[model samples]
Target: MDIKIYVCHHKEGPFFENEFFKPIQVGRAIAKKQLGGMIGDDTGENISEKNDNWCELTAIYWIWKNTNHDFVGINHYRRYLNFAENSQNSTISLDKNIDFLLYCSQNIVNICRSYDIITSPLCKIHQISSPNNRQTAYENYSFNHFESDMKLVFSIIKEKHPEYYEASQISSGLDICFFGNMMLMRRDIFNKYCNFVFSVLFTLENIIDTSKYDYYQRRVYGFIAERLSNIFVLKQQLLGGDKKAYHAGQISLPTFTRTYDFSELNTKLGFVNHPAQTAIEILHGGTVHLVISFDDAYMLHAIACIMSILDRASVRDALTFHVIHDESLGSPNISIIKRIFINAKIHFYDVRNDRFPGLLPRNRPHISKNTYYRLIMQDYLPREVSRIIYSDLDTIFLDDIIQLWNISMDNAILAGCLDEGGLTQSRKLFGKTHNKNYINAGVLLFDIQAAKAKYGNLRFLYAESLAKHVRNITLQDQDLLNISFVDDIIHLPLRWNVGSRIYGNNELDYAYSEADEKIAAENPAVIHFTGENKPWHADSTHPLKSIYLHYQERASQALQHAQR
Candidate 1:
């Protein structure tokens, strides 16, 4: 559809033919791409009704969007940019970079999607070519086209919003621009010319209103269209005031390692990730002491979770696992578990120690007189083993837990789950002995080596429960465990011990780790189900469930083989 969008008259020609008029040229060039409206600015002195033109490019955009690529709303206001040399003047800033033009197109694509879908320049649900028949649910997670757009976005952001220069450096996941917004991509496809398309729309709409910039400009966000990195664009006028924004783009964000494949996890029944030894590598470089104890028949699942955590870690060395089971339950195939840990260049040991704090409260006298112990304490672990990782069976791994395993043990005695506070007041009656802000024993990282060095013999092996009556604790293993380490443990990051109970429910800390309205530009390294959302269980909500389902596919094939 041909539409005449009149701009402030150009000296060389009317808006359409004026290449030297930046805003007009940017607008018309974008219009040809069929994305959206162009920015309008004119600088000339004759001062007639029409001659004044949309000069100075000063007025800010309020709200704008249409069904698809077309903009149905009319321009709201026109005024001169404050810096305009004269009220009636014409100035232009244009670049000949084709990549910059396509970078604009990327922004346009995202902006068009933000508006009503029916009016977008590109068709919805078109076949986005991928390497395979099935496509990733999250398509906008990488960038072969990043370097090109990075140059453009960084350059423009440097010119307009210098405060964000530091943040842009840490923008690790902003690869494809928008999260799950597009389809598959290749390295060379990024250079294509969709640039000026998005900029014109951004110029006429709200762009990014960053922390560093707002402090200086005394401006509110307006005329924003999502950039490829999903950051909104701003006019040159909106910038220039912030000191923190100064040369900020000069400081970049952490670069992405390998992209996480959430798409693989979203659709599957059960999938298996490659065997990674990330946990082992992180703890003491390859040595970790671990203990696993589950009551009443849940060993296979626990074994699976531990192996999965180990496999995902780059370091799978110097770790030990003690299985404290009263009876022999069905076992998982050794070959399968071995295959899972094929590359693990680590040592594994199994122990059958069953001593726990409830029965023999000798080493630690902190257990509540009313608390019944379901889990064995650190004393139950082998004498040689120090700093053990305790894991529950239901939990699974999304990334290397070793990064968690390797946490510095400077001053902490024990490590466990941070009390979620739902049942906060339960332990207050016990005073200092029972304690507040106690730990959850579901996952524990301890320093047995340090304990051994501190105490002459094993001081923990001789502690006893303080009560004449056993308190009926709400969480079986968690309560006593917490009371034991209330003053001793180090709180692990939420990413490492993330549980299913808080998946959609609890308030997020560092808050970004929880489910968010903003789509992740990239996938998480690991997602754990410490509570109920086990991959095999019916109530799973992990975005990467499909990834585990693929493993189920392999398991199914293996089951069929065994039957044959």
Candidate 2:
């Protein structure tokens, strides 16, 4: 029983190379041509260019369409199936060691002799609010626009492969399904699964509006495919005998880290004081503290968001900005941010070396890990700070900051504009009907002391929840915040955070109507570019695109002046 597992990689990394495993580069056709000889090509009989949409599954397609092996398997660049004894619960973190490779090369074939297919541990999506009513795997996908897509998938299956439709439906409702899309199976089973998944995904490609989705959400097809793999297995079991599969435990390894490495800076930079220990010497009686989180890549956007705040804020001089960032952000970017708001007290918090663990998850390529920074703000902000406004990098302030700061929390822990999209999808996501008002995390006014009192040691609680229920956290920090503070939330007015989704024809179900749209346009206190089309992108259709550019241009000029 010789097993060949192809480990997929997009960029160079310290992947293990041995007789059992081969490193294959996915999306090689559209990738830089210079990498032809250096990386494995996924061009012939492949969907290489759609890496953004297909993710690691493109490599799976390559393996199925091109490869000839007795037994085959697929794993990601960072994630792999752990085959070590008693290691079923833990993933093999491969560093500079080849022991993991040796163990897999030796044991994989033996394990396959007993099990027809080997898959990663089942991730169970349980009920969020009620213990009696647990959510199904189908319900989980439904939350992210997959409900309609799966309906189409089931219809196709029912029309074509009627025999498998009943089993597929049963599997869909079963909350436990193989996750990570990493599996080891015999060539025949692998071929069947591949044929089913790719066919369905290709059909979806032709039918679904891929162009309307943002870069992150466009990967819906891949997500659907992940669930389908389990459905395929379930179908086989229903037809064949039971116990045809084995659940193998896997581990997550840190594939890469982004670090600031600019050699031109004159000052030696390091982590400053801890948020808990840092004294609030700069705080005045009525000073408005604002917090924003982003990585170096989004420095320009963060600058624009801050600039917009400064431009419209009546209490400009009284505003103090706290930037939560990674160390990879160069000194030049930090200097430029300070230059943009020279009048405001700009403090930087480098979370690179912070002790908080598991706050960051396996984020999509587009989402920065810095997003998790907001969850740990309770531990990082000065104790003197009673209340603060936290905003996302994509937000632009359209009205005075004082208005947002003055909204009474009314005994609530936090206040934010209700998420129009979240409200519509609340039942599917949270399983609650009475509280349809889910506030967006993009723009929030945190009542610091109240929030701390409600959720004690937020960093610890967040880290614990993130580690245990990461799969449950579909929307990342937004989902975590909503789930954690579901009851103690105050819904602000829609105009406070008018998102771009409200205007487009592919608008969410809960989008503002024409009357509300006009009101938002006339009195939008904050404009959020929530969809895939951002103001920075060339194809941006945001009504307030010019405003973002206006601030961006000024930010660029300010940076140029600092450089000169």
Candidate 3:
């Protein structure tokens, strides 16, 4: 059988396409720019303008009107049906290797011989219902959504197709549902399903007043279609006696999108508007880009961190510093930095307070919103630049950063040393089944080209993944980074980022052994003040406080000389 499955996307991002799987842009009518080579749903006969409420249905409608194939399927950009026999029951797992999980057209054709329709496994309605509630489809819909709108849908179905109204009633009474609107079936069956789904949704759209609804609730028609899909399936089951019976098969797939509560946030970040400015430019060989984010409060520490790099780096290595900071980092500080690093290229990005209007409630007291500055680099940095080394302001360099930068990425998105907390923190963020070694986000070597190709819009990816976890964020951006790039990070040696946590605790909680940890601690390449006990604080008990103080004196002398 000739089969084609369209993966629907809202924005441009990393995607996979084969002969059997193609990319389609949803909401293209309202999108600012069309994704390069993907087909837009706005072409041909489409209700593309109503995508906000229709959701992915707009793609289905376009396919129904424009394309003709033996079998057709609809999947999301980040979610797809797993056709492999060995992992049929796995859902919500990371799509580390999506290609392996997907089967070819011949395999799908073989499976279709026994089943008429292929889709996600049916989930209990209460599993997604409002809190403390276990209700049937109708009751759950009314609780979570506008009750009147749902009732209106049922009435429209009763008036338009009375036979299916009985099926709708039967479906509403049951506690099972088909979420996400993903499906694959014969052309005939698909035509019938789309006709039924859009008919009811169009009628509801005309009668309902959704102007007062919030952005989420405005997507009412899409939510209604999920329940209607259940009605269509139940109706098919009821009519089987007169026909060759339709057999629906289930395949569990990972879903990347989830709903997040942004009530605590003042304003959500939209798109990148401003680009970073280079304060001073220098040209040299083996140039390495180093990025660090901080506020005025960390000026002394940030200066010491940068000086340590200059002090220890080889003359053969060229350096470029990208400083992302808030408004408080005044011109005096900028002048001082330029005077001190005369041979290096200095780029400054002055972020407004409004850029980060709100912070996550679970963020630790020591960690601030400044940590999120690294996430916005994807939008503002020059495309020509392919790599960056991001470090925290609370760190001191013991070895040349160019050495860390020169190491092979080996196809990983970023490379970093194992976190001091080891798998204990990993188990807390993800479940105990997590196998990937969690790396400290403080010191990382980012492969910019590969990461942008793999996951577009780093800030958006971080925001979406952060909402999926239920744990209290011990490290705000660090938690989000691990969640986003769980399996795509490379583990560097312990010497790269030896944390203060190891020096303070009697029982070391590091991923490396005691012997390895001691060796790295004694002659560390970079010392990270991981916890609250920082070297700058008067009462800090960090064993490496003296080393930091030595750099602090050097940084102070450089600042004074620049004043001259």
RMSD of each: 20.9, 15.7, 19.2
TM per candidate comes to 0.40, 0.52, 0.49
Sequence-dependent TM-score of model 3: 0.49
**Model 1 RMSD vs true structure:** 20.9
Question: What's the TM for model 2?
Answer: 0.52
Indicate the TM-score of model 1. Answer: 0.40
Can you give the lDDT of residue 561 in candidate 2? 81
Which candidate wins on lDDT? Answer: 3
Point out the worst 10-residue segment of candidate 2 by lDDT: 265-274
Better of 2 and 3 by TM-score: 2
For model 3, how does the per-residue alpha-carbon lDDT over 1-564 read when each residue is reduced to its tens digit?
A: 777889898975666788677889999999888888788999989988888878999999999999998888788776666555543434444433545335523366666665666766666665221222345898767755788898898899999988798888888898867677877777888898898988888888889999987655788888898898878877775644232223233332333221222221112211123122222322222568888877667777888998777766664236778887777688788887877877778888777654542544334567776787777776656677678889998888777676787777788997888887766556455432344478888899887788778887776677777677633345667777788888788888888898876565422234667677766766678889877768878999765677788778877887788888
The top-ranked prediction according to TM-score is 2
> Model 2: residues >4 Å from true position, as ranges?
1-285, 355-359, 432-434, 467-469, 511-518
Better of 1 and 2 by lDDT: 2
Q: Is candidate 1 or candidate 3 better by lDDT?
A: 3
